[model samples]
Target: MMLLLTQQAYADDWGCQVMLCMSNPAGPMAVAECVPPMQRLYDAMSRKGFQWPTCDLAGKPDTPKPFKLDARPQVPGNLAPQTTGQ
Candidate 1:
């Protein structure tokens, strides 16, 4: 019998910001800003036999709730549309 394993790496825009902070821990650390999307990616990777090491946040985790991207626009009706052609 043979055991197969896979690895998947993903970094979001927010995660990138955290990585820029050289002061952070040097091991696997989860940045709350990217948790939502990262979780989804992690789940998919797990299904394929990949493993993600646990991450510890120095203080409070920055995980933000997922928001719908396709929801209705919130532009106020009072705002006048700008004309491209004058």
Candidate 2:
């Protein structure tokens, strides 16, 4: 769908911008300035695929905890070496 494509494009652009901004000494301070625009982008993206929850997982009236990413290790490399011919 067009909406999904648009969302993906916007996300990619935002990610690039964030990465560029965070690659400097002033990166930490720059985050505050980026928040508003990022928030607006998120709002627009959410509107495209917004869905109301049937039940509150937190049990609170209006609190939601979204998923996040964490660093993880990659698969280990093979120890054996290959020969020229089998």
| lDDT of every predicted structure (CA atoms) | 0.47, 0.48
Give candidate 1 misplaced runs (Cα > 4 Å): 1-30, 49-86
Across 1-86, the per-residue lDDT of candidate 2 in tens digits comes to 35543333344355444444444466433677566545654576578675332232243557555345554434468644444695
Q: Candidate 1 lDDT, tens digit per residue, 23-80? A: 3454223455445554554566768675543333323458543344655455687875
Reference-based lDDT, residue 69, model 2: 54
- Highest lDDT: give the candidate number: 2
Per-model TM-score on C-alpha atoms: 0.22, 0.24
> Clashes per prediction?
0, 0
Clashing residue pairs for model 2: none
Scored by lDDT, model 2 comes in at 0.48
